[model samples]
Target: MEVAAKPAIRGAASIVRALEAHGVRYVFSIPGVHTLSLYRALDDSAVIQTVLPRHEQGAGYMADGYARVSEGVGVAVTITGPGVTNILTPIAQAFADSSRVFLIATNLERPFLNRLEGNLHELTDQLAVVRPVVKWAYRAMTADELAPAIAEGFRQLWTGRPRPVYLEVPLDLLDEATALAVEPATPPPPSEPAPHLIEHAAQLLRNAKRVLVFAGGGAVSRRVAPLLKEFVEAIGAVVLTSLMGKGALPEDHPQVAGAFGYRWSPDNPVVTLMERSDLTIVIGSGLGVRTTANGTMPLPTPLIHIDIDEHEFGKRYQPDVALAADAAVTLSALLAAVHAGARPREGWTPEEIAPVKHALRTPPDERTARYVPYLEAVRAALPREAIIVNDMTMLCYEGVRFLPVYEPRSYLFPRGFGTLGSSLPTAIGAKLARPDVPVVSLNGDGGFQFTLEELGVLAHYRFPVIVVIFNDSTHTAVKVAMHRAYPGHYRDVDLVNPDYVKLAAAYGLTAVRVASPSELEVTLRHAVEANEPMVIDVPIALERYA
Candidate 1:
């Protein structure tokens, strides 16, 4: 008697197997008709945890955040056309910041294409829309190709300049089952820095009287902070981190100058140092517009830029010595070269760095009736080891500038995407990853509203997250900027907010609303000391913060 053969895996099942082989343990998605097959496939997979997001945008942001904190690729599955379109903002952000993510989108059946003049959720070209925002895009044509396509997508997302990759599979292909081998693809090794290039970079640092090291989002890797801290100490170089790179070195460290770019005013000393420095050694930073004052195109200082992505090497600002290498490797090499050349300078003491730090430090009396005293309160309330997640808004600046992050990945934000509604959910993911540390979600009211539904998720899991909401009662950042551009006219911008404290309480979480700066410290302290998810809504005047 012939033995029964193993049941053939088809369509969604095969795709699930491919994902498992890729080591994707968690996937965030919003169910849609086109993706129902894939969704069904995820039903019985014990290895994969499927998180159902309230909105497609939230799904993408969740994946983006998970990828950021995990330092690995994250997956987002969405239906074709409109579902895919809804996630463009997060996709663009992931691309901009070199986030490693895989967006698996299910498209309309190939045979049914153009059957309707303008079908619902039909796009003239979905790939074209996503091309500008992804590292790579593919439309799988066959069942056999699905596994390899996913493997390749994962490979692209992990190699060199890690970024989000989009893959579209037609609904028809989802039903076809065939025996296919899913093989894991190996990502190309990061390019190594040249010996001479390292020597030249070290030479520039040695020759300059006031050398400044500027770190960017690309530098916020597992090994980057320690490497950067060691290098800064060894050379006695003044250090500054971009808004996204805040935690690249410990903020309390004597060498840290401050943050640079938007939210951080151009007049800030960090920007001043960039202007005054004889040499600016930029490491692992893309020097993007947001981080570089929309390319303020600062001084003609000699520059040595090092990053893993070659496209980012001299794209924004040309570098005198551009080395395309892994951040950790380049930093290590530079540290060795710097150690051989010079001893720590006596003049570069902690006291010497104090004046700049003091100038940049938020003043105790800076609080106004309208703006919440975020920096002062957070500085006082949060523990030294708390993991902070900052949403995309003015709050990001305050959080990074004020919060003391001792290591890389300690702080999370959408520097590249600048996407709102990420703070709370990202905090949940971070808390799950690092349960020992206290996690705080720092967000503006507008940003918080984007994924406020996640409060239910937080409540269900009983994740202890201290959510600090800057309740400005409107999108103050945009409204103020609009007023600057068009003084008299009111476009539909200001939003009336709900009672966030009540909303939090409805979800079985503790909540408080602080109306004055005086009340901020006590409220924040109480929230931090709580055991369950809590929201501290601080009513603020947006105008003052602006």
Candidate 2:
């Protein structure tokens, strides 16, 4: 008697199962011929939620934004060649910001690999192009290797210096069947803090009088805020946060100095404090070009760098002492050591720090009667907990400066990538992710035009996201920057905008256009109360803010 053959599993099926086992809830993608196998597998499985985006790039950005809010790995699936290339921008942004994301690309058949051959959707050295921008890039050669490759990708993504990972699955391999019994891989154990390194870091802090703490994106973990607050208060050290680390500490806290880089105001006090400090304790932040202004000058102080990734230390800037440990663990250990060597302190008072805080708190005085009314209207209409997503325009800078964020992640913007069309989709994702919280997307006229189709997605899903379009009728940010660069010359930067209110209504969403700023408050309240997807198109003078 012949034994029945075991059920053959496709490589794509194995990948889907691996992703599900790794706890990935959502997978965003734009379907193509190369991804048909995976699409079929996904359709057959009930483990993962799949979303189809109109554009591949939009899908990638949605994943990136979702990861930012969810604080977990986000996955985006795409076909080979153009599909994979289109997502590079979002993937690069993820890599730059150390965001956890997985990009699964379905490649052409193995016979057509890496040659100038005429195979459909074939690309020469695709993985090479993506390697520099990802934490790890893997190409599975066989069905048996698929599970282990995916497991490795997850390990690399979650390990030290977490970032986006890429896995390219060839069509031939995806179509092939296997009989191997794939056992689920065990996840690695969490890393522990080095006791000796913690003691050394503590000793440096205890001896220093003018101590400062620079917190980075990696320091934004859930427990980091309280741990940092405790450590800083114990050491009497002034605390500063990077742009990504904003709201890590309460802005009103006495020990909090201010945000270090990416300040709305040029003369930010945290920059001044960094320049004067004697000892700087950097926690979980890589002093990258943007964070440290391209490393033009060090902090003019002895630095103690603490992070999970050892390779990050002394990469761009030198450190006096480096502790390769998780931020929470290292902070906990350091706090204990510092408390043991407690000393009395004498330093600047709250009165001296008041001016710095006041300067940052001052609103932009674009006080045209119209502008004043508009600002007041928005402030009065929106709830304090409303999540505000801004576009990469002068309105965004104005919003960041004037609009208050009462909580962390409440203010979402593409600061690292500075992508224009991100606000609407990001707001949609944020609203869907947290239905109870009200979401407001502030987009410029130019930015809104890029992804206006997303309004249909909002309407279809019935997501109640409030969109406020700043109708300036131009790429005002570019025009202003060009004017400053040339001193007088104006180029092709102005634009003619459509009636956005009508555009919103066309997508089956509630829409209203506000011309006089006096109508802003009533219009906003009506939109909010409607409790449906709505747009409040506000016509504003760009010159006032820019």
- Against the hidden reference, what TM-scores do the models get? 0.90, 0.88
- Superposed on all Cα atoms, the candidates' RMSDs to the truth, in angstroms, are 3.3, 3.4
- TM-score of predicted structure 2: 0.88
Clashes of each: 3, 0
lDDT of 2 by residue, 400-514 (tens): 4444444555667677777778788777766655667777888888988887777877777787888988887888888777767875677777888888878877878888888
What is residue 169's positional error in candidate 1, in angstroms?
A: 1.4
Task: Give the distance in Å from residue 98's predicted Cα in candidate 1 to where it truly belongs.
Answer: 1.9
TM for candidate 1 is 0.90
lDDT (C-alpha) at residue 273 in model 1: 57
Candidate 2 lDDT score at position 494? 81
> 344-460, model 1: which lDDT tens digit per residue?
333255676778787666443453212335566776776776778888766565555555577677777777657778788777767766778778888888888888988877776
What does the lDDT come to for candidate 1?
A: 0.77
Instruction: Candidate 2: give its CA RMSD in angstroms.
Output: 3.4
